[model samples]
Target: MGVFSFDDEFTANVAPARLFKAFVLDADNLFPKIAPQAAKSAETVEGNGGPGTVKKLTFPDGKYVKQKLDAVDLDNLSYSHSLIEGDVLSAELEKISHQTKFVASPDGGAIIKVNTKFYTIGDAPINEEKAKEGKEKAVGLFKLVEGYLVANPDAYN
Candidate 1:
């Protein structure tokens, strides 16, 4: 098992609550609309859109990943989730964990942070390579969310 983590921070002019609502709460609807290249679509599986909810994201290559909400803190704008199941990368990944948090900066903007952990068996062909792939995907996601907030100032009401 290999452990890997990636962290990224983005300063968005949008409010924290607004950014959270669009990126985390309404991801099923908003992500596809903004980042069609990366996330073709998302569907809510278990719950509505809160803690314990399950969501599956479909990529363009016909592969999908399912995530189970582990924790949610609306006060701090943070949440954690683990990979329940997926064919994200060659079907060898057994477990993956990710957490996202939001902080309201003193400058009246919001900072978004993401961390990821991946685990695999012995000597997989793309162990570290897969981790790098995940980092790139995260960058793409941030760009899409940032672009959306930039375009729609009134999105999170």
Candidate 2:
């Protein structure tokens, strides 16, 4: 097995707490409502949405993903999860994990950091194009939510 990892960072005009609230804490409710092109719906399948909680996201193509929460730190404005089942993993990947952190910037905004790890099966190397595509999707989602909060300042406040 080979593990390929990467990290990405983005800045937003929204505060960490508000972004965190809308992005992490209330994602199941806020996500599908805004990202119809990505996911048709989202729901908690098990646990109380804390550590070990499993969240299922059904995509518009009728495919779905099941991710288990590894950690949720409200005070620190961070969360971690792994794609345990569904689309990606059942393909060429052995596992995929993600960690997201949000910190306050000097400009009263938020700086978001994302770390991703892709485990490939056997000697199969991680596909760079697919990895880049995944990163693009992640950034797109972040920007989508950021745009939503920017359009409605009262949201997640």
Candidate 3:
């Protein structure tokens, strides 16, 4: 198998703790509500949302992915998950792991850092186009969440 990894960072005008609560802890319920175009719904299919829990995210196009939670550190504002089953994985990927960290900024906002590792099928290289597309979607989701928080300052508090 081949593997490729990349990092992305985003700055938002939201507090780290609140953003972490909304984006990391409550994403299953918040993401779809905030960005219905990208995510139609999200549900926990197994476990209680901690490590080893499996969550499914359904998109507007009817495609879905099941991801297993690898780690979650609320105090550190970090989380990790691996895509275990999905149409996206059925193509050319063996698996994909994502780690995200949210740090407090001096301005009271937050800086979110994302690390993604793509594991490809045997002898096949990771698709850069797909990776780029995924990054775009992730950024869009973050922006949408940030906007929601900005508009509702009492949210996620």
Candidate 4:
């Protein structure tokens, strides 16, 4: 299988700790509350809510994704996971992995970095456009969460 990787970063006015707590640490409880259109529910389906644990996220459209937690470093505000199942996985792909880090900027906001890797089944070429589209969705979700945090200052603190 061939692997294609991509990197993405975005800045937000919300604090890094808050973003990490809401978006990464408490995603199952926060995502559905922040963006109901994007997520219907999220739950840990296997193991516990730690490294190697599996989480199932159901979308409003009835589609879903199974994410396996890889590493989570609270001190560094970083985490990584691999997508193992559900609609997000295409037939041509083996799995998709992501590493995300949230850093506090000088202004006390956040600078979020994400590295995504696509594992293809064979010589199948990755479609750049589709990859970009997926990234856009992720960015949108982040923005939605950012907006929620900005509006509710007491949240995720």
lDDT of each: 0.78, 0.89, 0.90, 0.92
In candidate 1 the C-alpha lDDT for residue 123 amounts to 47
lDDT of 4 at 10: 94
**RMSD (Å) per prediction:** 2.4, 1.2, 1.1, 0.9
TM-score of 3: 0.95
Higher-ranked by TM-score: 2 or 3: 3
lDDT per residue for candidate 1 within 34-104, as digits (tens), equals 77777888888898777788889998788899988888888888988888788864565667878889888
Q: Give the local distance difference test score of model 2.
A: 0.89
**Tens digits of lDDT, candidate 4, 61-125:** 99999999999999999999999998988888889999999998999899999999999999998
Q: Number of clashes in model 2?
A: 0
TM-score of 4: 0.96
Instruction: Give TM-scores for every candidate, taking all chains together and pairing residue i with residue i.
Output: 0.83, 0.94, 0.95, 0.96
Candidate 4 Cα outliers beyond 4 Å, as residue runs: none
Question: Residue 16 in model 1: shift from native, Å?
Answer: 1.9
Top lDDT hit: 4
- After the best TM-score superposition of candidate 4, give how far the Cα of residue 47 lies from its true spot, in angstroms: 1.0
